[model samples]
Target: MAFENPSRERIGDILASAGNIAIVGLSDKSDRTSYMVAYAMQNKGYRIIPVNPMVDGEILGEKCYHSLAEIPEPVDIVNVFRRSEFCAELAREAAAIGAKVLWLQQGVVSQEAAEIAAEAGMTAIMDRCIKVEEAITMQGRTRKTQ
Candidate 1:
C-alpha cells in the first residue's frame, strides 16, 4: 500500500526540529546536484552529512559518512538523492537507525519505500524539495521571527 504524505506544515516541523541529515548518494564534486542541494540545506542551518563512498574526504565543512549505518550519531532525517528504485533499501536503513523522517529529493519517488517508512512510523515525503517546503509551509513562523 502507498503511504500518506506528512503535510508540508508537518514537514516544516520535522525539518525545523531535525538536527542532522544524512544525505545518501551525496557527491564529492562541487558541481553535483547533491552538493548544491546539501549546500542550500546547510546554509538553512541543517547539519548535512555527506554519505558518498567515493569521497574519502569532507565536503561543505562536514565530515563525510561512508554510509547511514556508519554514522555514529543520531540522524533525524535520511535524505535520498538516488533513484526511486533504490529508495526501499535506504528506507530500510533509515528505519533501522531510528530516523524520524525519510525524504526523497525532487524526481525521486517510491510508493513501496514510503509504505515501509510509514510502517515503521516514520514520516515519509517523496518528490519534494525540503527547502521549498520550508519556505512555503513555515511562513507563519518565518513572519514571527522577522
Candidate 2:
C-alpha cells in the first residue's frame, strides 16, 4: 500500500496546533541543529521540553528528561533529532508515551518509525523541520516572542 503523505493544510495544522514539543537529542551545545531549531520553535511560542539522557540539566530553561515517558505531561509532539536508524526506537517510545505527533527532522527518515507511529494512530512528519514549518505557517501573522 502507498503511504499517506499529510496534506499541506494538515501539516500546517499540526505545526500550529501542537502546544508542547519534546525535542529528543537536544544538547547544551548551542551550535547543534537541534538547539537552533528548538530555539526557533520556542521563540514562536511552542513550549519545548528537552529529552536527552546525557544532558544533566535543563536546555532552554525547561527541565530535561531522560526519556519521553519520564515527562510529566502529555507531549503534543515528539521531535526527534537522533540518527535516522534510531528513529524506530524513538517512534516506539513516542507511541508508548502516547504522543500526538512523531516528527523526524531534516535528513531523518525511517519507514519502520513511520509505520510504528501510523500504527499507533499518531501524526507523523518525516524529513521536515518544525521550525521551518512554523515560520512558513506563521507568515503574515504576528510572531510571538519566546
Clashing residue pairs, backbone N/CA/C < 3 A, model 2: none
Tens-digit lDDT track for model 1 on 9-73?
A: 68777866878889999887889888888888888777888887777879898888778998898
In model 2, which runs have C-alpha deviations exceeding 4 angstroms? 141-146
**Candidate 1 least-lDDT 10 residues:** 137-146
Q: Output the lDDT of residue 64, model 2.
A: 95
Stretches of model 1 off by over 4 angstroms after superposition: 140-146
lDDT of 2 by residue, 1-146 (tens): 55565876777777666788999999889999999999888887889999999998899899999998899898889999999999999999999989989999988988899999999999888988888877776676553322
Cα lDDT listed for each candidate: 0.84, 0.87
Q: Model 2 residue 111 lDDT?
A: 88
CA lDDT for candidate 2? 0.87
